[model samples]
Target: MLPGHADFALPAPAAPVRLNGRRPIPEVPQMNGHSEAPSANEVPPANEAPQPTRSEKPAEPIDVWDQRVAGALAFLRRRLAGNYEVDDFGFDPELTDALFHPMLRVLYRDWFRTEVFGVEHVPVDGGALIVGNHSGTLALDALMLSTAIRDQTRAERHLRLLGADLVFRMPFVSELARKSGATVACNPDAERLMSQGELVGVFPEGFKGIGKPFADRYKLQRFGRGGFVSAALRTGTPIVPVAIVGAEEIYPILADIKPLARLLGVPYFPITPTFPWLGPLGLVPLPSKWLMRFCPPIPTAHLTEHADDPMVVYNLADQVRETIQATLLELLEKRPDPFGL
Candidate 1:
C-alpha cells in the first residue's frame, strides 16, 4: 500500500488472537474417576468445542472395501463426465485404472500370488525402459508385469508397453490394447514416449519368447536385433532389467499347430495341456506363484549419441539380457515350485 497506485489501500487488520496468542489447554478427561486441575496459565473454555488434532484420525473405523469402491466410483464418474485423462498414444488412464487394473490386480494377487523385489530400482518419476523375458503361450506375462508396476511402484505408474505390429492389426484386441496403454513396438514410438517421460515396457523376445515350447520354459530367447536398446539409447532412458518367473508355467504350451497358424494367418497356434483339447475353457490361465525381480537400472542417458550405433546397441542389449538371465536363475533358486512360494 505504499507508492503504487491511488487505489492502493491500507493492509487489513490481523485477525484477533485468543488469550494473547495462546490457546487454552484442553481438559484431560478422567480415566479413573479423577479430573486433573488446570494450571494458572491454562484455562479451558467450558463451551468451546474441541478441535481435532493434526495427528488425530476419525473415531469410527474406516472400511477398506468401502474406500476402494468409493475411489473407483469417483474415477468412473470423472471418466463419464469427459474429464478423463489419456496420453497421446490413446492410453485411457482413468478407464484403465477403474476397469482393467482391477482385473489384473485380482490375477496378480489371488491367481499368481506374485512377490516382487528390487522395486526401489524403478524411478518414482520420469521415463524408464523395463525389459523382460516374455512367455506363457500368450502375452499374459506382459499384463502381469504391468500389474507388478502398478502394485510395486509408489506412483502406481502406467507402463506404456511396446507390442508387436500384429497387436495393433487385430479388431477388439487392438482397441483394448491401445486403451490399456500399449503402442506399436517400434523405435519411433518408444523414443517419443520416453522423451515425454513415460515408463516404456518392452519384451524383445516378441512372439518367439512366448511361442517357445514348455521344454524351453525359462530360457530366454534372443532379444532380437537390439531395437529396444536403440530406442532406449536414443531417448536416453534408464533400462531396468525385469525378470519374471512362473509365467512360463501358466498355460505351458505343450505343442503348436503350424497348419492352423498358416490358415489363420497368424503366429504359431499353441496347444497347451488344456488348450485346443479343452477348447475355449483352456483360456483360463493356471494359478501359478510368480516372482518379478527388478535389478538396478543400467543407465544410458550419459552415453554419447553413438550409443544408438549397432555395435553399442548390441553390446548394451547383451548386457541387459545377461543381467535378466542371471536374475532369473537367482529367482528360480529362490522359488521351489511354480505353484508354491
Candidate 2:
C-alpha cells in the first residue's frame, strides 16, 4: 500500500500448462522392453518422427470408361493366353449367335437374302482346305464365307486366310487382315495352322484372282505350284472345293493399272466399269445377291504318311483345282442371277 499505486497490483501468477487437450503419447519400448524417459534438453534422432500409413496415400481418379476398357483388355489378354481351341478363339458358336447372327440379321435378313448350297460338305471336325474364287474387290467374299460357316454349320472355326505380300505390305490394312485371321501365304505358316486342326482358306489366285480382266471373269486361274497341296498332304487335311457366285460382278474392273497405280505399288490398277467414273453413288454392289456352296470334302486321310512324294502332292493339288473349277462352272450354269436369290 505504501508503493506508488495501491490499486495497480502485481500481475497474477501465470496459469499452469493445461494438459487436458493433449493426447496420451504412446510408449515406444526399447530393445529391452523399457524406455528411458527423455530429458528436457534431449533431442530426437532424424528418423524418430512418426511415419505416414497407407491410408495417407493420395487418391487416383479414374474415369468409368477407362476402367471398363482396362477390364476388357485384361479379359482379352487372359483369353488369348489360355488354351485357345478353335471353338474358343472368339469363334464359338455361342459368340457367333451373340455377335455375328445379329450382324447378319441386319445386313442380310431381308435385304441381302443369301442362299447357300452344299454347306454339308464342311466336315464336323478336322482340318480342311477351302479353295474358292475371290472377287468383291475388297474380300467381302472372305467375310461372307466366315458368316456362312458360322450360320450354316454351327461351327465357329476361323479360316486361316492366306493373304498376299501386298496384304501385309499395306499399313492399316495389314492389321485388319491379321484381326480377320489372315497370315502370309507361306507353306510353313499354312502347314503349321492346318496341323493344329484348323481350317485353312486360300485364294491361290491372290491378287490375280481379284483383279483379273472382265473378259476372263468366272474362269479358273492357274493353281500356285501345288504348295497348298503339299501343306494339306503333310497335315492330312481334306480339301473342300468352294464356289462363290455374285462376287465377280461386285466391282467389274474396266481399266487396269495406270501410272498412278504403279506409283502406289499395287499389282493391277482398276476402274470399276460404271458411269461418272463410278462416282460415290455408283460404288454400291449391284445387289446381284450372293450364293456360296461348299462341295464334297476331298480326303487326304488315305494318302500315305510319306506324302512328301512330289507326284502324290501334285496330283492332289490338280484334283482340288479341277473339282473347284467344275463346281464353279456348274453353279454358274444353274443359277439364274449371280447371287442365286
The candidate that wins on lDDT is 1
Off by over 4 Å in 1: 1-81
Q: Give per-residue lDDT, candidate 2, residue 136.
A: 58
TM-score of each: 0.78, 0.67
For each candidate in the order shown, give its overall lDDT on alpha carbons. 0.80, 0.65
lDDT of 1 by residue, 1-341 (tens): 56765652212222111111122212223352222223222322322434542223355335544777898788768777888767688998877886899899788877787766677788999999999999998899899889888866768898889999999999999989999999999888999999899999999999999999999988989989999888888888999989999999999888898999999988899988889878889998988878778878889987649665898999899888888887788778767777774
Minimal lDDT window, size 10, model 1: 12-21
1-341: candidate 2 lDDT, tens digit per residue: 56776452221222111111121212222342223333211322212333332223334335544677996777577567773343222234333444445565444434444546665677767778888877756676776676666555636565667888888899877765665567788988888878777778888777778878777888877776878877887788888878887778777777785686789898776777662375876666666655566877778877848478888887777777666676677657655665444
